[model samples]
Target: MKMSDVAKLANVSPATVSRVLSNPDLVSKETREKVMEVINKVNYKPHIVARQFRTKETKIILVVVPDITSAFFSRVLRGIEHVAVKNGYQVILGDTENDTDRELEYINLLLQKQADGMVLLTARQDKEKLEEIAEHFPMVLACEYMDGSNVPTVSIDNISSARKVTEHLIQQGHTKIAHITGPINVVLGRDRLRGFQQAMMSHDLEIDSAYIQEGDFTFESGYNQMLKLLALEAPPTAVFAFNDEMGMGAIKAVKDSNLLVPNDVAIVGFDNIKMASVIEPNLTTIDQPKYEIGKKAMELLLNLINGEALQKKRFVMKDELIVRESSELVKNMP
Candidate 1:
């Protein structure tokens, strides 16, 4: 159906209908609702390419994620999709596949005016580069963020969440704790590591240098790191991993070595992925608002795109610590 037909049926001018469809905020609230009702009733679809030629907007959003296979990013993507669809927009998935070059290629799409806006799930770009991009396009960061840039971000307090989980293990009287970290180059890895370290120091616990293992946020890396830590003269009584994938890997390694969970060695993880709750012994992990972060990031980006001012650029979400059998001692059972 044509937009003119929609305008006639809705009792508004074609220009008003165009404004309602392309940028709802520009129209009056009553007019927007009436136009949308007519739109839904007629199922009229605009020719996006023609619209783009006239408005310089594709009505498509570019969502860039570092890894496609990771469940953590997938959850965030779901949230982003929900908001995009409701706002008459399409989302293009840009999987970086952990390659910086590939990531930059997706960003360049924005520079080329293929996408109206962008939501960066993983912020690996240099501060200057990200600033340059944000200056020219509407952008928001999710999960990961820039170090000192003004780019809006939606994420939890990684350090506090990590420290709180570590403190849980310490409160249970487990010392000699080992840490399995994400790649130290990123903020997620660095903040989680600092949280673990700070928690250990707060309790006057001996921070074992040999117990720190760096993982690439993968199961294999977690398994391998756990093996290395197990080989130490005195292995840790508990292990904290930056993510659930690594935590599960550590559990497998411990079981392989004939060690009991929470008895021989307790395990804790961040990011309460689905597997975290389904494992043999449910994982004790931090529940980050992955879905909410994605939803908010898109909202912020849309506001920027619609020329609305954002009162707050940075949104720090809250996290909950879930305790389960993975980190619970049988003796301490109620």
Candidate 2:
């Protein structure tokens, strides 16, 4: 049935019916319920194609991630989906697989009018290009952050959290601490490395160059880097991996060598993913509010889409360092 027909039966004007169908939050609960009852009883379904043609807007959102299979991104995706479905928007997942060309292809969907807006989980594009896109389109960055660019972003304070994790190792008497870093192309990775350096410098600990290793935020990379660290004549007493996958991989590397965790080599990880707690010798890590970051990113994108002014462009969420068995103090050490 038509909206006008539904409106007539509900004894409400067509505008009221439209408001109820689209922006239910604007209507009073009682009125909304009444309109919904009539809608359900009559089995009224709006002509989506016709509505799109009239508004020149697609009620669709694209959420692009570097890796869709990542547990961290999956949690964030759930939050984005929750906001999109509640606001009558459908979400499309674009897994770019950390490829810049693939990322641009997914972004092209917005340019082609296939989607209304985007929530970028990671961006491989340059600052100027991203700025230009934000100026002309509805976009938001979640988790991945750019330095000094006015792209609306939602993320945790990576530097401070990284410092906290490193300082925890220091407090546990880990002087020769090693670090596995994520790719330094993004600000998240650089800030985390900076935090680690800051904590070490502040404690007057000499950072061995050999102890710092670059990882690609993957399990295999962590395992490989840990192997390198283990081969060093003066191996580090503790190691901090950029993400949980890598941390678990490092733990596996240590176990394979017949070394006991916290007794021989303590380990710390970032991103408190689901597997962190369940793994043997639970990982001590930085707990980023992944779901909240996703929800906020989608909210910001909605505001941008509606031509509403944002109070601030950058939204920094809180992060906590979870102390677990993996980084516990060595009882025999002074």
Candidate 3:
């Protein structure tokens, strides 16, 4: 039913009904109770579209992810949505497909008042443009961070996590460990690569140039890089992939070459995605708390949107190592 009908039935003007709906405290206690009763009786619904137009606040938060198809990102999205819905806010998702131009375009949409704030999964973007957008908007970085910027970010310690993974390989008596990673432009990729290098250097292992390969964090890239590594004169006895997809690809490559995992060449991957457990060999990788990261990022963004003082500029989540059949140490020597 219309607000006019409710107003007439409640013995109040339309303006009074509107005020009660928007801010009940502004109306008298008796009048507010009466209006609410009428509203309940009629099951009256206010025109949120018009109200949003008038207030210029849509109460919507936009989440821009680099690859929405990744199980890793899906979990993160769920975390953000859960906290957002609990706080009486709506979330809109945008997948940029790792395209810098598209990412920038999505960020530009915020300027048109389509969304009140943004949660970005970092991709390659113009730093100056991002800083410009952040000046007037509430934004949080999830699963990635930008160096030399004060942007609020929630992510795991990639360097330490990668080092741990490398250390595990070392403990397995695998001295010739190879590393595959994503593009160096992204923070996570660079940090993980650095972690791998640091761990090798600390152990006095030569950081062989030929043992490192770069991928685009894609399954195909992983497969291709693994093939290239396998073609080397002395293939690594163990391989470390930056993410789960690449690690899976590496597994496929190894199988195609008629080699056994952990026996001929052990493999470890990052991002303990759900499929990691169900896969044939089961993946050994770093377990990042994707859902918690998303939840915490949204909570921080909501607080910032509410003009609350933020005690910290950045937040780092911890990572865990899950050993599986894929990276089991070689037992018997031929």
Which prediction has the highest lDDT against the true structure?
Answer: 2
Per-residue lDDT tens digits for candidate 1, residues 136-189, read 799999999876678898999898999999999988878788999999998899
Q: Which candidate, 1 or 3, would have the higher TM-score against the true structure?
A: 3
Q: Which residue pairs clash within candidate 1?
A: none
Give per-model CA RMSD: 3.8, 2.7, 2.2
Instruction: Return the lDDT, model 2, position 122.
Output: 91
CA error at residue 319 for candidate 2, angstroms:
0.6
lDDT tens readout by residue for model 2, 174-238: 89999999998867779999999999999999988999999998999999999999999988989
TM-score of 1: 0.88
lDDT of 3 at 325: 95
lDDT of 3 by residue, 9-41 (tens): 999999999999877889999999999999998
Question: What C-alpha lDDT does candidate 1 achieve relative to the native structure?
Answer: 0.91
Q: lDDT for each of the candidates?
A: 0.91, 0.92, 0.89
Model 3: runs farther than 4 Å from truth? 13-43, 332-334
Clash pairs, model 3 backbone: none
